[model samples]
Target: MKWMEFSVHTAQEAVEPISNILHESGASGVVIEDSNDLVREWNGAEDEIFELSQEDYPDDGVLVKAYFPLNSFLKETVEEVKQSINDLLQHNIDVGRNEVTLTEVHEEDWAQAWKKYYKPVKVSNFITIAPSWENYQAAADDELVIELDPGMAFGTGTHPSTVLCLQLLEKLIKGGEYVIDVGTGSGILAIAAAKLGAKKVEALDVDETAVESARSNSSYNHTEAAVTVRQNNLLENTKMKADVIAANILADIILRMVDEAYERLNTNGCFITSGIIASKKDEVKKALLQSGFAIVEEQMIDDWVALVAQKK
Candidate 1:
């Protein structure tokens, strides 16, 4: 199906509010460009990395996205959203929030057309992701594994959240320990843990696409992680305890699920939650504390936050 593409460029700061308006009005996807105004096409990577879309970025934080349904009330929504954009433009704001770009996608497959862009990506010292369309080679001398392919849910390891998770996974995961990955998009975190030598891994996602994608990727890793991919909200399918729990989910979800995370922990085990907004860190911390966890450390990259907590 064809789509109407909208490229709304404004001071990066206004991107988020504009995106909220567009999404509320019904946008399938929104791309928020970086400070450098780069909405990257990591060459075949796809997935919603966080609750925040490109519309949430600032300073050249442009929204370039399209939604299928050419004959919908897209024009009315665009015009209505433009009023908000213009109000921002009328104000003296940061550099990225001053301009707006809008356009329509006259033709192209709005569905399943992103597959051609998926390719192999190297994330860490011994890890690489190869989609089903690509091939991966591991040197015998090198400790390498983390084979994955594109899926509908998220986490091909190219996204900021996934990248952050992989970075932390590289630092935290050691050999022969139980690991649990909540919101296991494409099984990226689970696959990373398995590659890092987790004795057993439990990967779960509410989305069926994510479950299937993760299972397919695990097969490619050849390391054979005992992964249980399920369609529950969080930790609903697993009664098995864990030494580590990784959650790359939205702030609200993290706060709501902190108790479950603490309940499933194996004393002193780490709970790593990313995909939090810098603004919501305090609330998440409070939730963690209420759930009997102490903040071990907190890290931020751009607007995203990664909190490392330990069970008491």
Candidate 2:
């Protein structure tokens, strides 16, 4: 099979929104190549090391890449993608150069190449995300491991936004509480919640591919019995109440769903949100407050910020 590689040159601030745009355009998986990774410090478990090369990254800005199966409508899809990326500027996002290029390649060329870069990443004190291909052992008796393929999904559960969300989950989950992971992506958070002793987890995503990937990851992690993957759009038409709701998605989307999340959360239940760039943090915080949530905690890693809010 052949795939079209869509690559974008953009600023760090634009990475999240641009990546979201690519995912919404039917990309199987997204790859981010930020130049900062070359010099960034590795704070993983003591034994973990990332061997990165200067040649593999952009010199000035971040490169966001995604793959789409070659199809007749690809040309149109590419055009739409470009337009959507440009539209990010309307949200006050810095898109940098916003240059886009497409290359055709065989599936075999990239299907396994990216795996070498993904290893067991200790995203939080209690949780580590390991690729299904790697044999990762828990370093401590209390450490929880989430095995994921990510396949063509959005993330491997190691992104900063995801890490922040997972950390908040670890701090908030007290076992046997119902949790809902909106825009679950690869189902990392839902699985984490289950592993952390959530009695039940509802992993929701609007994309069928994401829904399937989440289900597969949950089953692989042996959390299927407690984690239910569903194709739903940000709590729309859902009636189940949750003790906690986690959403690691674009801040704009998070704003759109704030009311829904607030409504679905039980008394004193927390709403954990990430995928917010620093510039948009205040906007999200205000929305959460207006929705009757009292901001309880906030954490920032690099340019991403995650917030934990409790229902008043």
TM-score of every candidate: 0.69, 0.94
Listed per candidate, the RMSD to the true structure in angstroms reads: 7.2, 1.7
Question: What is the lDDT of every predicted structure here?
Answer: 0.65, 0.88
Model 2 residue pairs with clashes: 28-152
For model 2, residues 139-239, the per-residue Cα lDDT tens digits are: 88998999989885566776778889999999999989999999988899999999999999999998898898989889999999999999998899788
Candidate 1 lDDT over 186-219, as tens digits, reads 7778877876788888888776766777788777
Q: Give the poorly placed runs of model 1, Cα more than 4 Å off.
A: 1-59, 62-121, 130-132, 136-140, 143-145, 152-155, 223-225
Worst 10 residues of 2 by lDDT: 41-50
Q: Candidate 1's error at 305, in angstroms?
A: 1.6
Per-residue lDDT, model 1, residue 56, is 40
Clashes of each: 24, 1
